[model samples]
Target: MLLKLDLTDSRPLHEQVAGAIRRAIAEGECAPGDRLPPARELSRALGVNANTVLRGLRALRDEGVLEFRRGRGVTVLAGADQRARLVDQAGALLAEATRLGYSRADLVELIRRLP
Candidate 1:
């Protein structure tokens, strides 16, 4: 996978890593059931600490975009592209809402009130 990091980005390294992977998945750079490069390999390529890569991968797994299997390694989950896009959109919405002085509960309530 080709993971790109914007050195100028102010977000945490882990978040940038996750965003790169998420974009790759959304762009069809990888598909469902496709195994990801090992975290160490990714760290080496991205020039970040292995733990940082793992943290990003863990975040993806938590977002349901990737799955971790013993010995099988990390693989993209089915429907990951769509899910990743939705997750990204939700994140953007949350950030915007926060910037507007709204809390998480306010965002949730706003979403709930949507038709």
Candidate 2:
């Protein structure tokens, strides 16, 4: 999955990284046991620091959504249970977006613009 970044966002870059990865997982772009890109590569792709990528991956690991491994980089943690948890996470995000004045059309536009 690709992480399309918004450079102007007020949120920290690491959080954006984490949020994109989380969205990919939640939406089934990446699935159980899928390998994530290495920190340096992901950092380059997103135009952020390698450390920032790692920090975001670490945050996901702490949340039980990803696993960090030596040499192998990050991997999705989803099995059946984890997938269910991710769906809940997605639902919560969607609800929050709605609460914050995001319409379905807005989300569709955002996804449509992702590279």
TM per candidate: 0.92, 0.69
> Candidate 2: minimum summed lDDT over ten consecutive residues — where?
78-87
Q: Write the per-residue lDDT of candidate 1 for residues 4-53, one digit (tens) a residue.
A: 89999889999999999998998999999999999999999999999999
lDDT by residue (1-115, candidate 2, tens digit) is 7788788876788888887887777677888888987889998988888999889888888878888788887788756235546645665777688889998788778768999
Question: Which residues of candidate 1, in runs, are more than 4 Å off?
Answer: none
lDDT of 2 at 86: 66
Q: Over 4 Å off in model 2, which ranges?
A: 80-115
